[model samples]
Target: MEKNKTIKRAFIASLPVLAGYMVLGIGFGIMMRDKGFGVLWTAAMSLSIFSGTLQYVGVGLLAAPATMIQTAITSLIVNARYMFYSISMVKKYKGTGKYKPFLIFGLTDETYTILSGETPKDANENKYRFLVTTFNHIYWIIGGITGNLLGQIIPFSTRGIDFSMTAIFIASFTEEWIKKNNRKGAIIGVVTTLVCLLLFGEKWFLIPSMLIMTLLLSIKPKREAAK
Candidate 1:
């Protein structure tokens, strides 16, 4: 009974992620398909890589004859913010035992938001966390496969297709903004991103902004708690 309820709660919490991942994963799939990769490649990337922004960036990398060192460096730089996110989750994930591996592997931005904010009270925290991660992961896999299948059947216009990634960011930011507590974080992110863009230019803004935002976000909660 508890497990069933936990699953239901996890599904509900994942509804928002379901929508986001479906669109973003499809965008990724369409891009990969247009690059001549098939559903297998799409599914493998979605399941294994699982980083939306990196996977989108990866389309270009996978097509080019890049060396392992370059790929490793690029991945490290792009997904470096995960280090900050993981720090907050240390206590929540401790002693998770059997579920720890998948929970760690499946910790996407959306999954983190749900597990951190919408965690259930009626069930074991670790179990609920596992279910939420599974739901979001499954959504991404299915969305990627569906998009690849559709891509095989229908051709997509090349123009403006890459903007889907931007669209995903906007949607996620908007969703976060609608919540009262998340408002400050959203503002911090936008301001940091824009300021970095102006200071560093488009090419270098992303890493600086992410680093600054992670610092602010990590510190902000502690400041608020002290007040």
Candidate 2:
């Protein structure tokens, strides 16, 4: 009974993610199909890699004759933000036992937000977290498969479809901006990103900006505590 209740609650919590993933996954699928990749490829990528932004970027990588070393470097740079956030999640996930590995594997931006958000009193927290993770994964897979199928028959342009990933990031940023009482981090991120863009240009700004943002955000909280 308790397990069932936990599953239901987790599913409910993941509903918003369901809506977002379905759309983004479909967009990714369409893009992949447009690139001459089949539904099986789309399903395989989504099932295995499961990083939305990376997968979106990966379609281009797949089309190009990029070397394995080049792909590895690009992936590291693109997913570097995970390294920062994953540090914080370490404590919260400490005692998750058998669920720890999958929980870690499934830790996407959305899953991180849900797991870190709130927990119910008396609920089996690990179970809840696992269910949420699993549900979100299934959602993405279904969406990817569905979109690939749709793309095959629907004669539509996939141009600009990749923008869906950026759209999700923008929406998430906007939401965080609204909810947080401390706006310094957001301000720092925006300013640093713009400055880096101008200085480093579009192709090279991301890494430098992220490094600066991480440094500043990390320093601010400690200095405040000292005061």
Candidate 3:
């Protein structure tokens, strides 16, 4: 009974992620399909790699005749922000035992947001986190497969589909902004990103923006040391 209740709560908490991942994964699937890949490829990537942004970026990589080193460098640069997420999660996920591996593997932007939030009273925290991760992962896989199947049947322009990722992040950002009532982080991120975009141009702005944001957010304000 307790287990079932935990599952229920986790699912409810994960509903937002479900909505977001479905659209983003479908967008990814459609892009992959338009690039001449098939449903199997989509399913495999969604199941294994499981990073929506990376996978979307990967669609372009897979479409091109890039070498291994290029793919590695591109992937590292694109997913570098996760380093910060993992660092934050280190203590929370400690002692999670069997759940830790999947927790780490499934820790996408959506999953991270859900996990970082509060756990329910009298519920197993690790278990709740695991279930949320599992549910979001399944949603992503299902969405990708569904979109790939649809892509096989329907023909349309994949142009602008990639923007779904950006849209989802914006939604998450808004949610965090309202929930935390802290505007400093958001302001820093926005100002840093715009500055980088203007200085570096769209093609090269992401890495610098992320690096700058991370650096700024990590700096702790110093107060007079206890007199």
Worst 10-residue stretch by lDDT in candidate 3?
Answer: 218-227
When superposed on Cα atoms, how far off is each prediction in RMSD?
A: 4.0, 3.7, 3.6
Mark the 10 consecutive residues where model 2 has the least summed lDDT: 159-168
Worst 10 residues of 1 by lDDT: 156-165
Q: Write the per-residue lDDT of candidate 3 for residues 112-173, one digit (tens) a residue.
A: 87687668885678889999999999999998988877855546665665565566577777
Reference-based TM-score of each model? 0.78, 0.78, 0.81
User: What is the C-alpha lDDT profile of model 1 across 72-134, one tens digit per residue?
Assistant: 988888787777678778988898999998998888877776676646678767788888899
Clashing pairs in 3: none
- Can you rank all candidates by lDDT, best first? 3, 2, 1
Error of 1 at 37 (Å): 1.4
Model 2: per-residue Cα lDDT over 1-227, one tens digit each: 88888888898878778877877888888899888898899999999988898999899999995789989998997787677668869999999999998998888988887686666654689999999999999989988888888845646665565455556557667777788835787799899999999999987788788889888878858776685
Model 3 clash number: 0
Clash tally, candidates in order: 0, 0, 0
Question: Please, what is the whole-model Cα lDDT of each candidate in the order they appear?
Answer: 0.79, 0.83, 0.84
Model 1 has an lDDT value of: 0.79
